[model samples]
Target: MTIAPAASTSALSFDPADPVALTQALVRCPSVTPEEGGALALLATALAAEGYEVHRPVFSEPDTPNVENLYARIGSEGPVLIIAGHTDVVPVGDAAAWTREPFAGTIENGILYGRGACDMKGGLAAMAAAAIRYRRANPDAPGSIAFLVTGDEEGPAVNGTVKLLEWAHRRGERFDHCILGEPTNPATMSDMIKIGRRGSLTGRLTVQGTQGHVGYPHLADNPIRGMVRLLAALDATPLDTGTAHFDPSNLEVTTLDVGNPATNVIPAQAKAVFNIRFNDVWTPETLAAEIERRLREAAGNTVRYEIGFQPTNAVAFLTEPGPFVAMVADAVAAETGKRPALSTTGGTSDARFIKSYCPVVEYGVVGKTMHQIDESVAVADVLALERITHRLLASYFAAQHNA
Candidate 1:
């Protein structure tokens, strides 16, 4: 099928060995959340050139924005290895403050600068390049290789990977393992490999009260006071000591809102939002019950409050250390000369969604500049990441064939 040129920038020649050009080309597309911006089309065109059967499906919900997602596969059979990432980037805040055009995809002093460069259009480019190169060299490679690219990761994530996976499953797509190309490295390309992610839960607590003159203590019930006390109760004790594979659970109050400007009047209601990054020791149901128990005990009969939990699919997960992990780690060490630490300390990603299907891990470029004004990635690191991915594919397919 013929694909149209990307709307943001003209299509450039794509080379499998050199991912820098592809990275630059992709960054030129201004694909902010829920927008196509020709990013997926560009990728689909490039993958089609490499013999992948590409499918672009636009998913929708009642209130959420419709999202476009891509699923492309190159081979017909064997162990399927899926490389997942997103092309849609977060909104560029205050464009005037940027050192260069946020969508220009400029390379200055050997660094590629643009949104999604590190967080992770660069990674996506590298994965594509690596897959192409591997397919060319090992035309009869034992397993199939696929790309699951989404445009809804940075938004509410309702119509993205979670739904795409289900769609693929209904069509009888079974993956042996998956790799998420999120920006996992905190410092350098070789810093770490994410084996797991902490679970996320957000709660909105609203305390009810009677509005009255501030001077009349007996007539007014101040919900703000009760809100503060209840929050303190939730924060008073540690959720748990650090587990062997995870850190201590943390609850942070993100916002407190009473919205009352007049000092003479007590507000009728106070609301506070808190988010918890919990470990595997607790499930969402248990955690919610525990939190409610604490709030009820702290509130007593005097404080009237209501707690509600936001819907979330982010559950804590771990991919045990096995041949797959060791193989990827070895590939990194071989390419960068640094043994990466297997860590589970980061915010959640789409890996949380893929864990249900198969073993999944995350490793990509350095993320220090992701979502920043002058977001970028070192050109050299992009090439290195491509090489690492290439090596991983080679080893993975070889092991499967031998086994």
Candidate 2:
């Protein structure tokens, strides 16, 4: 599938220069999770200048940190397309590791350097710049587009898109589809697209026993022994054989702690933490029960243990082959001539939430440098991404209207 001709100043009316600038603008803002840091205000101003009706909502749950989010709509008709992303970034660790200032948004040797540059301030800029270009060319284009942005995607996620979706739904707002600008590609811009994601579950286990001198092995029931047995039981059993759409479910032990410093003392307690990245074979509830059952059998009634699960709604989900996935696959082929894989390999993402509201997929810049020191995106790749996004918007809407 060939894309429309290279954008001219007429078809590509928006300042091509501003996309990199917008990325730099966002990176300069220290909008860490749960902090607006003026990022939302800057985005709101940019969208409002383009005639979008924008809404900024600050939401809070009883215990979660209060969050700020934004939703903007430019038209209000059929096939409403939603472009969703987050302005918040994870904390930049050890600024000394960076070649340039983390927030400097520096451009050197044709690469943009900053915290959110790849993970996804750059993606957001591409979307915004493309929207501007599309609007300028097709001033009366059919259908409509909106942006559902959140500031809590990087935090505990208590008051972000999950709440924003409900708020928008109450106001009678609906979306036919959504595209998240998460950096999904691995080594190259056209390497892959995330059609689905594996689910994640975290659990903590605490085993209790008598505290005593190590010399008196016969009298003291060492909690460390019980912890070892329980952990081995869980690890010995495979979660499942495997699934066609997903890889084998794997569990990894994250932490094992006893806290006892004395060489002659048997600690009164032992703790182990484990996380599972599972496939569709298990849900949070079922997998959790299975874990408890294993622990019970392993201890053999000798040790008292407490298992606590901090379940996240990162349920495994897939967007079946359809127009949404097809549009991206075709766009990647058109731009790079490579047939990218429709993968479910990565850890969970915000798409886990958006999937429940509408069919969603993730595609964006190659992420070789994302979350690493001096994270950067190549200038040529960024330009290619803008072209790909612009073509997708045009083709997606064109198909929606035609259908």
Candidate 3:
């Protein structure tokens, strides 16, 4: 069910300096995927009150849902630091399974419980809070602190960062670096910082065959036999020996379906869906061509087959460990007493879009509970991340000023 603005909605207040309160207020909006749920409106008001020039742009792509996005900035100058996030969260499946109301932003003991608590509403709040603090302290701070918040990240991803970045570029907005507040840490708040992400490609492969009764052995051609052979060939060879900062590319066949349940018949068609998490070694075009090569070689003109590749914008990217990387790591180390590892082992994020314009890395809350029932984040970690982000913001401008 889509959340309506005029129904079951009311004005919600927030303190720009308090992230926990911001998280609760934002989560309470129920901004489920593709729904505004007043999250952007609430943020716009808060940011505007803090003297930010806010713009709520509505983007649309044919066939996909039109989504509302937020782009707010305080200072516009050289070396802009774009803070990116999403208000849209995955749906709460089987709401009855949750220990508390998923959108209520309940707190138990020391944990904040809610749907988007850790997945990213909390992370986004922390970023906003930290930026507010920095801006209030340094009203004339050098560089820029802009937000690229979207409501389509958990959906088709068509009307979100991919388009928002283009909109920013069209207006001659240049970004020097980006910090995406996703729930990147797997265990503790300081375990890992995602420096890169593997590219993803999904494909559908179909094999054609003849259908006949069980009594006719010679007339029936079983596509299942061809499917098994082709599947093996696809996964038989290693895509690469692992990139310098990434794991070896891997392909997994997610589903295989023939659509025939009867025992006395041979299915006329067999289709399989597969996805690949590839490294920087291959582009989508090269990878698709290689898969076709393998299929044609294995089929050898005997098995009639078809292949189709889905459009992908998620190409592998890396923010090589440089001055910007060191600054962020220092800020985290200052809070955690340990240096976080610069890792490239994770699924995709909006960073893929941001990287096209500037160097982008990810850091946020402990993601153990994101997208799961009874999702929650520790109060300590949330506050700690805010402090870390605050330090990063301060140090970032200090460096720019000194330079």
Could you tell me every candidate's TM-score relative to the true structure? 0.96, 0.94, 0.96
Candidate ranking (TM-score, best to worst): 3, 1, 2
**Candidate 3 local accuracy as lDDT?**
0.89
Q: What is the C-alpha lDDT of each candidate?
A: 0.90, 0.84, 0.89
Which residue runs does candidate 1 get wrong by more than 4 Å? 1-12
Error of 1 at 4 (Å): 12
In candidate 3, what residue range of length 10 has the lowest lDDT sum? 1-10
Q: Among all windows of ten consecutive residues in candidate 1, which has the lowest summed lDDT?
A: 1-10
The sequence of per-residue lDDT tens digits that candidate 1 reaches over residues 222-303 is 9989998999999999988967789998999999999999999999999999999998988888889999999999999989
Residues 35-103, model 2: lDDT tens digits: 887677777777777777888888888878888888888887868888889999888999888889998
Q: List the residue pairs that clash in candidate 3.
A: none
- How much is 333 displaced in model 1, in angstroms? 1.0
- Candidate with maximal lDDT: 1
The residue-by-residue lDDT of candidate 3 on 1-403, one tens digit each, is 1211312223345466899999898888899989999888888877878877777777887798889888888886887899999999999999999999999999889999999999899999999999998899899888888988899898899988888888878878888899999999989977999999999999999999999987996999989889898888898888788878999999999999999889999999999999999999999999999999999999997888899999999898888999999999999999999999999887888888888899998999999998899999888888999999999999999999999
